[model samples]
Target: MSYDKDDKRTHLELIQNVVTRMASNSFAIKGWTITLVAALMALSAASGTAKLFFFIAYVPLLAFWILDGYFLSLEKIYRKIYDYVAKDKITNEEYFSLNMTLYISRYNQIENNKYSGFKHVVDACITKTIFPFYIGLTVLVSVVFTLAL
Candidate 1:
């Protein structure tokens, strides 16, 4: 298929937009997790119910951690799409195709079954960027709570 150079550029730009949005969403989730946890901790300390609020805080923390990991995985997938598109690894038929399943299947085939869907999200959760921050926060909160008891 004969494609316009401009069209390819526009399609790549669209994919890039999705990637950027995923990254932004991840950042926002992290911010909210920290803010909510801190607020809950402060309230607990002030209310003399550190045990209850500290336990409650874990719920949001774990929820946000999972959410953040999900977004990060999406970002990784879009990034792979962008790389494929930029390198012309994808055929002309797939040009401007934002369908992720097509790319994911292709990736799985290329990687020889190394790409399990849920495993990707779990991997994102343990990445250096995501794991350290959340785990550190959890540890800090646990220590403070323990001392408060």
Candidate 2:
């Protein structure tokens, strides 16, 4: 399937848009995580059950951490797709195909790579951009809980 220059450009734009949205979603998830954690902390302090509420807060923190990692992985996947589209290396059959699952296995097959399969989400969780913030929050909660007890 021969694609015109315009067709390829449009396809690339579509992939780029997905990349952008994934990044935006990741950012939003982070924001929500902070907000929820803060609210839960405040509730715990006010309720005099700091231990219980602090523990409960961990639920959202871990949940959001995983969710954020998932979004980050998707962003990475779309980015790889954008690179392929930009290079015009996509096969004739895959031309303009936005299905990302087609590339996930290929990405995983890269030798000795840490970011593969479910590990991709785990890797995303520990990236410089992600790990510190969540770890810091956890430490803060632990310190406060200890002080309260």
Stretches off by above 4 angstroms in model 2 are: 105-115
For residue 55, give model 2's deviation from the true position in Å: 0.9
Model 2: lDDT equals 0.83
Q: What overall lDDT goes with each candidate model?
A: 0.90, 0.83
Supply candidate 2's per-residue lDDT for 18: 89
Q: Which ten residues in a row have the lowest lDDT in candidate 2?
A: 105-114
Per residue, candidate 1 scores C-alpha lDDT tens digits across 3-38 of 577877998999999999999999999999999999
Task: Give the number of colliding residue pairs in candidate 1.
Answer: 0
Clashes of 2: 0
Cα RMSDs of all predictions?
A: 1.5, 2.2
Task: Looking at model 1, report the run of 10 residues with the lowest lDDT sum.
Answer: 108-117
lDDT of 2 by residue, 12-98 (tens): 898888889988898898889889988988887788788888789899999999998888888888888888778766677677888
User: Residue pairs in steric clash, candidate 2?
Assistant: none
For each candidate in turn, the TM-score is 0.92, 0.89
